[model samples]
Target: MSWLGVQNLGSRKFTCGHCGNIVASSAGYTRNGSNQRIYICSHCGQPTHFDVNYQYPDIAPGNDVQHLPEDIEGLYKEARNCVAASSYTGSVLISRKLLMNIAVREGAEEGKPFIYYVTYLADKGYVPPNGRGWVDHIRKKGNEATHEIASMSKSDAEELIAFLEMLMKFIYEFPNKIPC
Candidate 1:
């Protein structure tokens, strides 16, 4: 079997979502006749499956954000995986948690209300001034997901992820990349 012209009969490149490692994958076909191939990451032993004809099955696209603390990075990656799996509500919640994680990492105290973290980040200049609007949007949407019966759409989740990515880049990536 082959996907994206990479043979599934042998070792292939794969990114493990659990540990965020890009390494060779051990491949195997499921016994069921559905033609699904399971690829296990050699480094972390996490398994991901792809249909025989599915293309672009990569879990980790690329690491564009730099200098993120490990915990924050893990949350962001898990949020991305939730987005990929079409779990929009899950993605939004994860993004919300990522926001709180950022706030705490930047020295906000834990155990406060969720909005407290949001306000702290904005007040302390962790997030850009104009970006506070969407930061609140993420918080509101995440509340809906957690407290109400509302379900998040793909577009909404993607927008939140985009905003979160920008905030990460601004707070962690860009500053670290600039010459001191």
Candidate 2:
């Protein structure tokens, strides 16, 4: 790959798909016989390819929540990463598992069926008012991703992750802000 000493890709700020940090992109290069321009990440030194108007390894959505258990946090981050990496089904599956983990951490019994965790969370009010419907939707989407021929779409994963973010913030982050 010869670095053609010219920036075909204009200077721009980007979220490094590899590192997840926002950085002013390094110089862009075009290889011989290829139409795409490649720019290296300033933060991670990983290269991001630009073809027409698209990027390789699209930036993942979602951010870390405070006061979350290590395992749950890892799973949450992994789910977001999966979505960013085009693993929509995997993200949904991980989000499903995350619901169970959250329920157990919030005092629900372990080793129960998936629905048990959902019901437990809802019964105990961990799902908040009027949130049961979407909670059930998450479970249903997860089931489809797991058992059905239909794979999840990017929007589906994004929607689930968005809900999970809010739920976690409510159940874990916001509550912990009070005096002990």
* Best of the candidates, TM-score: 2
- Write down the lDDT that model 2 would get: 0.87
Worst 10 residues of 2 by lDDT: 1-10
Candidate 1 residue lDDT tens string, 86-147 = 67789889889999999999999999999999999999998787878988998999999999
Each candidate's root-mean-square deviation in Å? 5.5, 2.2
* Superposed Cα deviation of residue 113, candidate 1 (Å): 0.3
What TM-score does each of the candidates earn? 0.68, 0.89
lDDT of 2 by residue, 55-152 (tens): 77778887779999898999999999998788999999999999989999989888988999889989998888999988899899998998999889
Best model number under lDDT: 2
The segments of candidate 2 whose C-alpha lies over 4 angstroms from its true place after superposition are 1-8
